[model samples]
Target: MQKTNKIRVGTAAVLAVVLGVSSLIGFSSSANAAPVTINFWSRGAQADFIASVGAEFNKINPNIQVKVTTIPDAEFVQKLSTASQSGSAPDITSVDLILVPYFAKNGVFEDLTSYTNGLSFKSKLSPAHMALGLYNKKQYALPFTAEASVLFWNKDLFKKAGLDPNKGPKTFAEIEAAAKAITALGGDYKGFYFSGACGGCNIFTFAPLMWASGGDILTAAGQPTFTDKNVAKALSFYNRLWSKGYVAKSAKTDNGASFAAPFAAGKTGMVGAGAFFVGSLKANPEINYGVTPLPGATGGKGSFAGGDNIAILKGTKNPVEAKIFLDWALNAGQKFIATKAILPIRSDIAASDYVPQDPRYKVMADAMAYGKTPYSVAYTPLIADGQSPWVKMLQSAIFDGKIAAAQAAAQKQALAIVKKQG
Candidate 1:
């Protein structure tokens, strides 16, 4: 119920950083310099990948040097904010899709739409992913990855539950029923498990349930739509699952452990996760699992679109060079497809090698076409706050024995926040 403090970056320092980059870019090295040292920054988690991309790019454009550095993942945004205010920001940076809205809103990015005009690559990206890096109809960034929520069930668990391992749940009702059966097996494992603390995953996995059932937290115009009966019905489904003890208690405090730990340990019957999950599964062949689509409402399927975005800083003096690099990233051939990402927001490459061919990966790519992404400005914090109420409400209603009060209280609070956002 307490308001979470806003951890926004101070504006002054960031503004200064932007100016510094601009001045540096203006300095003349040689017209065809061998290394045009450009500062590149990435958060801890993505630093390695960015470094690899830099290495590959350097091989082709040896004259253009990209110096990539890692910012602590937890503090990456704040650091960027600080750099921008301080007027010492990097020439280029990769941002989480969720943060794009905030950066775009602040006018901290170079508008690449005009530079990219005449390019029809935008049509190649899925609508869900295409929306992540867009703000006010301008393209500030290009997508670096595409991910969505997918159902992952332990084939062994399904067999034990008298369900077909090859045929996973297609509808929410079926998933609920299967979960109940898995719980009846009764042991260290549960029928299903997911993060109660994870806002992004909650939206990806659960919001679809709300939307598929004909409800949504916010409408296309960004109005609160949670008070609608459909929304309440979706919430009720979650409540019923928790109340029935199909969810593990550990899920309450767990944001990461729920899916990875349980699935890796072979304790959970089912989970909804991204395609990257396959990499983790590969590490542990001992754990047998199968990937399936996220369950639909009655029969319809949908999932949230997710990915990273790249943008040039607002004050960059080398918009031409930066735009060249952006274009190269989305250009045809191996460079575009080599990153294991979806499309480069370019259709030509979207259907090319970038689209995975494996059965599991194909499912992910196919789902992208139908996915929908939430537009949450300052998304990292908004998601945390938004999902917390629903999680707490479900906990009390299902586990703590206060169904009616919990429902009324949660609905009352969530609706208020939604209204405020509207």
Candidate 2:
């Protein structure tokens, strides 16, 4: 049986332990004349989900209310940086997971080793996400939401192309062959689709191929290794498909805007995307889809674990209220996310906890387990920046067929950027 209790002022509240899952919080309530507000800043792309989570949070914790601010993804880093430097940072923020290392390195977030260690699900949290939130052995954040880049195949299109609708490609060759067969159907039938000109999108989707094939573009210490053979193979994989005209033309020009339109409309056979893709296509039940972790050229599978990490800012005045919210996030908060059809932070969450939802969630979960993220303090300039060498490298290799030149230039540019960060 479950019990309910309203948290009171200045008293330590023990979060109810339920279903073998538990969390501990001993923070005293904020001694404020006015009701304490926990300002939670979430990126615009994630604002809707964050707003829903905020509403649920207010329901149980009557003493504290989370104020959510939606910052456009394009301006989040700049706005947050300005706020942090001027000593006006939000009580807590959900930052892009890949940028966690960058923020931690720059001392933008509070050290949460003590708090994170207390959470029971800390051990079960996504490893890729946990690793990102660490800097100098100090934990700065906890995964708020998880998004794993996995392969999405249109099952109906597969059957129409004379392929098995149930079986998705497990290797690059299989993917290519599937594309060929699908493309043979001619008019508007795309075999494989990609955001050829989008750096972030490519890294989210394409880098996993290199990872699966035992190739990595960065050393653990934030050094660039872009000239690896695995990277060449991954880029060449797209080059082969593009050269054969099996890829959609939109791919060459897509700079991340509406990249999924082709695939979601059931015209494209295979593409790489994340959980948000499922949410976007939810209204279109007309298309039968199947998902798998991105596969290597020969056989291995992997994904880019991308999404947001929740961390209390370094100078928050409402530490107690902020921590109370954080504690709730690790338990009930995760349950809330599951209800929204988003992936939970904890790997151990029961299937019953999530929406009786897409059966393909298992694929996303496996991808999360199998995935890894690049750890670098120079992440913005190296990968996420619009003008980064990564996008140019992909374009040069995939579209211009300048693999050697592209690799050399990218390596040199990457080294320069990382050196500047040092």
Candidate 3:
């Protein structure tokens, strides 16, 4: 095979493919052999799933071994940035879709377009999934899983609220009325649950409500749009929920877990969650729950796209073998799909018997169409920083009944962020 660059990148930027391999002794070999050991890294609770996938890959090609490293998600960006700066990054890495633009722009990864040339990309993935790898027209990352936010409701709780378990509300007004009904009959019950503490999940899960209402945090060119009327309107909607006591006040610091607990414990009627939530629910055999698409805002559907991305790191000694690894990893038959908790990225693979037999599996596959992820270079990591102010804005307006000032403050803070990013 011809020598070329085979590094992978994250979402939104174009990746360039060039032919060349490093002369590093540990990674380059005449063949896939014991001499070659590829280093890789990832963060988040999903590390177990990734490790399982890597293990499956090794079973098929024992010669090229992959050494996996995991760091807590809270420290992921810090560790990855430090490693990248010091030239100690692994041969492969799991990059967040939002972080891809920043990492690729900073020259932290190699372009992966060439390596993906002979593989079946289109038939395997959805258009949105394919778009995650395009950074400025270059291909850097390959989509490994399809994730989306959905409305998960406790069937038992819904029935208690005098609503049909199978037929949830279809519009925002209906949702509001339902929430009021649920709250009116409250005894350790909440109509809606969302995180005022976790900006990463909140931005995706809640921002879509605004997007569906026809507003966005930023434009494609990376300018502020938080002042848009639709944004104010959406914020007002959530604010009403908070004022009506339909929301859990504990959301102030809980991020993802707090919202999950109330719903999981059967105390709350509805919570917005991702495909992974299906697995979480399955683990609890006692909770009888049903999921539906998030309600449309003014007659349109929207939600955040959530998933991990796979990429080859720069400075690797074997481009060819890495390509083989990526192609094989994307195969529909990999054991990782069933055994691991992550859902498959390929639509064709998602439809296969290996994944389709389970009833809850269908919702995981359906979420891709409803999910939308941010494309900003630095916006991703900022979500985790306490100073981001997204949660406080929601609380100020919704919980405190200060809609006008809250909207203005949120817009100011959001614009400041965009300007700082510039």
Candidate 4:
């Protein structure tokens, strides 16, 4: 993650003053104090887990109650936007990492720097995940969970291709060679799979390839850097795989959500995706799979660290109560690691025995050391505009056979978007 020293200490100082005053007032009126209720909205998949955590928290702090509402992932952002405008937003909400900057920039969240600084476990949070919560040097959100993209290879397919099933590809050349070997087997199986048209999917799985090659789409200053030679090198590498018929045809139109279907169905030898793919693969039970960190252009590894972040909305009536819930929810790392089979945002818990003992999950856990989030300013507009120039660039290069022109056009458009955000 890119670090900027542009700290807004003033925001923390202001929040501290408000919190101090509220504490004194609450101390004086303890006998007459009423129960506090805070509304929390989160994505559907984590609803049950979050509600369970809330139940645990309420047992300890009987004066505070949490009301959790689950929203469909597809409609979360749109609904949050509507609620924010109408002053009906929940007191607290969990948002995708990519949407954090857009909300922070639009003044929809409250700065939590002071609260975070006060926590005993603050330093135990993953820096890469915490970096996602930052906007204009202020911590407006907190890392709720963490995931890393990795390459999932079918060991059975590898064995059939005459390659060692235990050894996963570690370089772009190795990946290509392995794909070629698998494709040479005449069957309905494709060598590789990915969502070619899905912006978020490609960014999560492919941007790390660019990073591992020592290239980035944007600088810390939020300037476009996609025209770099290494960027082109990585993009061209994908073009080669697509052009050679190694990638599945369904990839051309697969949205990120369903791209893993081919791999799960045992129709593809390898798929690049996040830890969630483990669930799908496990359900099949027939495809013997192993996970590895995404291979670099040379031999290094890089991954995109992604997950939802929790934040307090700007107009919450009970900021203090909301903070209590936020801290409690995030601190329940053991529950998430044990129950969800997902990594915790807290480094201490992630490194503890609470994490799964399975070796496959270790691939993702180890990759977190070198994982990164995109520079937020560049990412926000790219997502908001619904125009992923990188995906288009790949489409042009592989499908339209216009590599050079596509690279030039993408760089120009990406630069314009970043400059406009400035």
Candidate 5:
């Protein structure tokens, strides 16, 4: 056997690997062990799916049972933080990828470098998500579910507007043309819709468009690039649509309360949304739709990788059992995840690997090939906040037509905030 260097980290002793024992521990069945129950916490929306996975795990490892708890998502962070500080955290946590940096930096999560390295599919994890969980160059969490932003064109409406029902727009001009045609339908018909005042929604949709043209909201140094030409062009494209009255007026002040309502109601021809939208539209089967990756001004496509990453919190009684769950989640458990129309964390898994009720599920999963997540410790403050400079910039440019001024002001504010927060 080859000798390897090993090191222990923090309270969990997240060991380094010589020849990873963690892998063997994770892969072997846990039925031989004494009955042990581990606590697992998941955000409210994911609780049902999580509980099912837990039940499945128990079916195979009868002795190592997992108890799943639902944590209201709005209070999840604060509660988790407090519990982590008191060393009363759960054995396993399904953490939002964006929150990984904060927890990883504070050492709230156990270092899983050895176990992660041992996984055969480790290289298949999203690079952006993996990087988010890094602290001092060590891995902490693995992506759990994957969400990607996709453009949705109403197929019935497209056919009504004389556009090809079978084809969706692929560039800025095409989107504009399609929107204009749809709006010309008169009475209760609008070309496009967006939640103008929702920062999170924009990141899921608009940010991908910003990135499609080889531009980014954050520079390599983790600073703002709101003033990038590509960004301005993308914003301007929307501004023109708004100015031409191609976008629904409700979109101007929607504030996310009725974000996707117009589209779901069949009152709008197109919208940008994620996997949840596909699921949400199940009740609106009357509205036929097609999904495509958000497109750039000239060409290319992009999407924001939004979802949770699973990790073992620092003081768990059963790291081995936790490893078993995490391993299964990234490996065997992926079958269930993909079945739900979500992309698997492992790149080797594709949407076509299984049949989907909605063929667009294939489009959503296929988008992962070009999906990305931004890097910044101040993501919530500078981007997710509805009143943040980033969001306000979009409102200013699209609603107020202050394109140049908005970009400059937002760029400055974002930089100062990022610098101070860092």
Candidate 6:
């Protein structure tokens, strides 16, 4: 059996507030009225945060109670699949952004376009996140959180390499130069690290490099275009770095789950990461680090806009109540940003003073302006089957010394997968 936790209201003050607000709104007056409970599921790591939000929501809407179940990341999709088949799915779920298209296509989620159309906050959501929720012009999901992949460097390591600790690489050439400088110091330290074995990580960090160079992994029709010149150029750049011994040896075996450990441990000089990395690095006070937008291949910056989307499942018996909860949570705006430390999904929040004034956060906020997601249709099938072909291609290029062969094979496999999905 899967582990589960249920949040219940026990505080008198909280109950008083719930009753007071309901009475003021003329929603309910009887203290003995039983609340209608709705089931919600989210990633296990965010169980506490979601539980808090659920508690607060219960305070305002006394008629509806939300029971949140936290599921492990690796098992979430499979568990949801099992539940869907058995007619036991939760009313609401928080889904990984990239998987939204696949779920929507399979009719696992309800089309929320009509419900969201009348809401003012609907227009405020980030376009990049909106792209993930749209399928055939229908909206099936709403943005829950936002994040972008960026470059992070250790200031202490930079200083030892005789490089300015205050400045970060803005172009591929600069990154290459910095990597060489740091590697020259020798020992167990490596200049850079990334998960070569993780396909999701490759899409998060490496695809942006290709995008910044005017290349894309998939065409508009959702077909594989990895053989495109721009992508090949980015691959060649990585091949060069791998051949020069600048990347950590562990990169070959590390998956997305543990890729950042070496960077946090102070063994790696630079890493490509997202906002969550900030908290992880802060936990290690000894490693002084700085962040910047990911450098472009030739020049400029790029980032993979990523996060989760919230949706009501098609089998939900409380669609109206679910919509109400979603609208309230999203309209909380700055409160959500402060609590989550994530990029604001709302256009109004992104532009307002609600964001932190710190420089590190500023870099991430600015990167959001140019950040992009891969074409959703293509990306859906590529990642849905299991380990992505693109990831296999990367491993092949780095470990097997077969860049050309890997690129060719990946293109073939990607095209087949996309076509079959269609």
Best-matching candidate per TM-score: 2
CA RMSD per model (angstroms): 12.0, 8.4, 9.1, 10.5, 8.7, 9.0
Q: Which regions in candidate 4 have their CA more than 4 angstroms from the true location? A: 1-36, 44-65, 72-75, 378-380, 383-386
Candidate 1 ranges beyond 4 A from true positions: 1-34, 44-48, 71-74, 332-350, 354-356, 385-422
lDDT of 6: 0.78
lDDT of 3 by residue, 1-422 (tens): 22232222422123211122233334665532334578777777566577777677787777777777887877777888898778787877776666677677666777977755656555566456556666788878877666777778777777877888777666778778778878777688888888777777777678878877887767776665655778777778777777778887787667566656677777777888877777777778778887766755665767777676778877767766666676776773243665555667777666664356566667656767656776776575335565665665666766676766766676687777766775
lDDT of each: 0.67, 0.85, 0.70, 0.78, 0.82, 0.78
Q: How high a TM-score does candidate 5 get? A: 0.85
lDDT of 1 by residue, 1-422 (tens): 12222223445556666666566656645433235677777666454356777677777876666778888755776888888888899887777776787788777887877764666655665566457667899887767656666788888888888888888788878889888988888887688887766665677677776667777666665444444666666666666777789988777666544545677778788888876666568778877787777755686776666656778898876666666566666563234444544333444454556555555666676667777776756344445553555555545644565655765676566556655543
TM-score of 2: 0.90
- Across residues 91-204, which tens digit of lDDT does each residue of candidate 2 receive? 999998988888898888999998788776677888988999999999999988988899999999899989999999999899999999999999989899998877778889
State the local distance difference test value for candidate 2.
Answer: 0.85
- Which run of 10 residues does model 5 get worst, by summed lDDT? 1-10
Q: Roughly what TM-score does model 4 have, to 2 decimal places?
A: 0.85
- Put down candidate 4 lDDT per residue, 271-314, tens digits, no spaces: 88887667556679999999888877997888988877899999
In Å, residue 264's CA in model 5 sits off its true spot by 2.3
- TM per candidate: 0.81, 0.90, 0.86, 0.85, 0.85, 0.87
Q: Worst 10-residue stretch by lDDT in candidate 2?
A: 15-24
Q: Which whole-number lDDT from 0 to 100 does residue 275 have in model 5? A: 78
Name the TM-score of candidate 6: 0.87
Residue by residue across 1-422, what tens digits does model 5's lDDT show?
A: 12232222332343434235445555555423345788888887575467787888889877778888889755677899899988889999887787787778778899999887887777778776787777678988888877778999999999999999999899999999999999999998999989998887898888898899777778755788888888988899889889999987878877677777789999799999987787778889898999988999887998988778899999888998888888888877887776665566666675435325567777776776578887676877887677799889999999999998999999899988988888
Q: Name the runs in model 2 displaced over 4 angstroms.
A: 1-34, 350-352
Range of the 10 consecutive residues with the lowest summed lDDT in candidate 1: 1-10
